[model samples]
Target: MNSILRITVCAYLLSGCTFANSEAMPYKSWRLGFSAPNYMEVWIESADVVDIKEQVYPRAMSGTAAIQTPLNNTGDPRGWPEKPGIGKGKNVTGADLPKKIYVRWQSLVEPQTYQMVINVPESTRAIMRKEEKAFCAFDGKWITDYRNALVINLAPGGMAKIWVMGSCLPAIEVTKVKAVVDPRGPYEGKSGGKYDKLSDQSKAYVEKFGVPYDSWK
Candidate 1:
């Protein structure tokens, strides 16, 4: 090939490699896990988002009293499952990992959805990439050996945390959201339109665990 043609071919090959790296996550499975004191739901807000659900274990089964599973489009009440998780898990492909997620849950007030950014610092990702089969300093109960994962954790009252396998990053309290309203559930109390406030009962739970994994608000 001529010098110009050789340069063109090398550039094309380099671009292809970059595309592959972005499309495939460095993990067996990437999970979208959320929890709360009550019911909640999480969905990918980004278009062309990757979903490799078949790669995740313990998929949702019909008629299982477990009530919460990845297939439920939800999170069961009272927090993360006794198992690894009760939310969505997939072997994402076709695009770069997303930087945000959507969380929906009903509190004393009607359910609202928040579109919040997921901030995973490079240092955190590096720790997860080299992580051994150990525990997450954040999600203590889960003893999973995740080498590298993109796990989103949505706490109640718009508080968000994330799990990158072995690391659970700090909380990102979300004050602004779309379609928020007043509390009117059976546990009805005045929210004054600020959805970030916890209900009377849920407040107690917060002190015990820094996790909002809450009424799923």
Candidate 2:
């Protein structure tokens, strides 16, 4: 009778384990924080594109047309992890940066969407177009990849305050701006490498046994 009871208990526990593992996991969303704005009712992102880019230069020479291409070094579809071309600029020594402050919204959905609201100074607003691309330079160099540019179209003026909203996270702010154009995606660079393969569960086996705990009378 004791042996039969032990077998019944083992079956019950195994069924519970299978049921728990079969349930699907729920999806969750998160919001990453940036600097706060000085004003309220600032229009946030309703929808926008998240662009990424990278450099693809096979070789570099001392005197020749500098080659630049959109590419990524990492094999992951997310785009290149680093942009090396932007570091070739004169270093700044405690330079005061212009205040073009804004807040970028980072919500993780299926495709992962982003939106930003930037308050451009009145002086730079007059020239701001309906669709403008601004090169996002970080630290010192022009970010050539995932650290690419933020495509924002601001109202142009000398001192008129305008709110610029768009999709995609902004480049690291400390980096200054150099050029402007439409934002692009990560460049698909070299593609000739093998990736790690996943293992099959069928090839592995586990020992199955029965053990009894005795506390019942």
* Candidate No. with top TM-score: 1
* True lDDT of residue 32, candidate 2: 19
Best by lDDT: 1
Predicted candidate 1 versus true structure: per-residue lDDT over 133-178, tens digit per residue:
5545656655545444444444445544444443343222222233
Candidate 2, after superposition: displacement of residue 70 in Å?
11
What global local distance difference test value does model 2 have? 0.20
lDDT of each: 0.35, 0.20
TM-score of 2: 0.16
Candidate 2: where is the Cα deviation over 4 Å?
1-104, 109-116, 129-217
Q: Evaluate residue 126 in candidate 2 and report its C-alpha lDDT on the 0 to 100 scale.
A: 22
What are the per-residue Cα lDDT tens digits for candidate 2 across 33-87?
1211111001122211110111111111011111122222111112111321221
